[model samples]
Structure formats: structure tokens, C-alpha cells
Target: MALIITDECINCDVCEPECPNEAISQGEEIYIINPALCTECVGHYDVPQCVEVCPVDCISSDPNMVESKEQLQEKYHALMGKQ
Candidate 1:
């Protein structure tokens, strides 16, 4: 599943650069994760970099945007232009 940044985010500006897929961005209030571009770092890293670097622990999997590991891998591949 794609990750979501909660309102608890402190806007520390750490999570943005940590995203391998460049899915995190500064929203009107807090950081936002683009679900379309998010793949939970499946094909890039063992863990989501944003979640790893988030000091406030505001990042979590989107229950509403639930997806399997295979689906995330496919999304990652597509984003990377892989076969």
C-alpha cells in the first residue's frame, strides 16, 4: 500500500528528500504522499525511506489505498521504466 503522511507531521522537511520515488511533497499544511507515485520503496529499498527518516512517526500505510506487495513492485517497475 502507498504511505500516508498524517497531520501530526511537523513539516521537518526530512521526508521529502528521503523518498526514492519522489512521491512525498509539501502540501498546503503538511507533507503529502502521492499515492500514484508511491510504491513503499518496494523495488528500491527494504523499507520506506520516508518512514525511516520521519522523526515524528507520522508515516503509515494507507488502509484506504491498500495494495499487495506484488502490486507495489509492479508500480515501482513501471515508475522506473523496468520490464
Candidate 2:
């Protein structure tokens, strides 16, 4: 599943640079994760880098954008232009 940044985010600016897919961005009020570009760090890292560096623990899986591990891998491959 894609990750979601909750309102609890402190806007610490750490998560943005941690995202391997560059999915996290600064929103009007808080950081937002773009599900289209989010792969949960699959094909890159063992865990989501944003989640790992998030001090507030505001990052979590998005139920609405639920996806399996295979799907995330596919997305990662697509993003990297891999076969």
C-alpha cells in the first residue's frame, strides 16, 4: 500500500528527501504522499525510508490505496523503467 502522512506531521522536512521514489511533497498544510509515485520503497530498500526517518510516526499504510508486495514491486520497476 502507498503510505499516507497524517496531520500529526510536524513538517520537520525530513521525510521529503528520504523518499526513494520522490513521492513525498510539501502540501498546503502537511506533507503529502503521491500514491502514483509511491512504491513503499520496494525494489530499493527493505522498508520505507520516509517512515524510517519520520520522527512523529505519522506515516502509515493507506487503506484506500492498498496494494500487494508484488504490485509495489511492479510500480517500482515501472518507475525505474525496468522490465
State, as a TM-score between 0 and 1, how close model 1 is to the true structure. 0.97
Whole-model lDDT values for every prediction? 0.94, 0.95
| Residue range 1-83, candidate 2, lDDT tens digits | 99999999999999999898889999999999999999999999999999999999999999999999999999999999998
Among these predicted structures, which one has the highest TM-score? 2
TM-score per candidate: 0.97, 0.98
Model 1 Cα shift for residue 27 (angstroms): 0.3
Given candidate 1, what's the lDDT at residue 42? 96
